[model samples]
Target: MPRTFDGATGPVAGRFAIVVSRYNENVTGKLLQGAIETLTQAGIADDDIDVAWVPGAWEIPLIAQRMAETGHYAAVLNLGAVIRGETTHDEHINRQVSLSLGELSLVTGVPMLFGVLTVNSLEQAIHRSGGNVGNKGMECAEAALQMVRLLAQLPE
Candidate 1:
């Protein structure tokens, strides 16, 4: 028989950090709200969660890296909204931020969730941030909690 490791759902025990972009306040704000609400509902105290706001999605990785390196947070959630514009700016931002956050998580052994929304329009962004599509922020928070528990079960 083969054994399997599963992330059990329950109240998580640890501190968390949310690095959000201030560029798209309309969408990112809701993301921050969802992440916080999810974390709190899962047993993380208000003070246990710290939020840092950056200028844009480009700055998320730096702040996220800093928070994760502190060894204070079990995971770091990166939230932002990069709506497609006239240029290819959104593409670059999304790729770089995603790569950087993923690499940072590997280097630090701490969960770094990519909750940024790289959507085509404001309507799409709205639909994802606590909208009909569902909140990516809440999803990120849940992933963070699961990662923390999953990692704990792995052998060092």
Candidate 2:
């Protein structure tokens, strides 16, 4: 992220918090790494980024809500993989977590960046996490940086 804004140029301040799901470690691990790298590149130090891992996708929002409400982070980044299977189980988790994260951002007035992948197959998730589709983790970090900067410009 560019530190210099149009007329309000200033140092990008505040820390970031990440909530990662360990259910799909193969994919989520890569996502987590990418997110960390991106945040660092955006001027956030490693020490400033706090990471919390949860059991699975379903558990992401609860922790994310808690983190967002802490008022200690400029943004909360959530990363996970929710792939479709024979049943509609993935659908339920995806809808609830996605909606809840959205609600958390609105209610807490904090930026909740969703890096979760809701895909039809492992291949698609792979493509997104750090594959040809580009890393959603990096994308989420960039988004969080942008939103944090914008929100900082707003009146309290």
Candidate 3:
């Protein structure tokens, strides 16, 4: 038999930081709501979660990095919606934000959950935010919880 390490069960305790983009508030608002709800449901108190509102997706990484560097949070959730426009602007933002968040996670040794929605259309963004596609915010929050628990089981 082999021992398996899983985050399936455990008491998740720690403060969490959510860096949400104010752009596309129509979508980001929902994402923020879902993330907060999920965190609270998982035994995280409201005070345990801090939220920072950035101007847009491009600004998420900087704020998230600051929060993660403080070593005050067990995980950081970055939520936003980048709807593709006439140019490749969305592509650049998406790729760079994703890369930056990943790097911050590695450098800070904290779980950084990427919940940014890089969708082709507003309809698609709606679908993922809280529509039939499900809320990415909720998904990210769940991932954060799992990572927090999983990391605790690993050797440091």
Number of the predicted model whose lDDT against the real structure is largest? 3
Q: Each model's TM-score?
A: 0.97, 0.92, 0.98
Q: Residues 1-156, candidate 2, lDDT per residue (tens digit)?
A: 756443133457788999999998899999999999988876788999999999999999999989988899999999999999999999999999999999999999989999999999999999999999999999898888888887877667
Alpha-carbon error at 46 in model 3, in Å? 0.3
Residue-level error in angstroms, candidate 2, position 151:
0.3
Q: Candidate 2: which stretches are off by over 4 Å?
A: 1-10
lDDT of 2 at 91: 92
Once fitted onto the true fold, the runs of candidate 3 whose alpha carbons sit more than 4 angstroms away are none
Whole-model lDDT, model 2: 0.90
Best by TM-score: 3
Between candidates 1 and 3, the lDDT winner: 3
The per-model lDDT (C-alpha) reads 0.93, 0.90, 0.96
Ranking by TM-score: 3, 1, 2
Off by over 4 Å in 1: none
Model 3 worst lDDT window (10 residues): 2-11
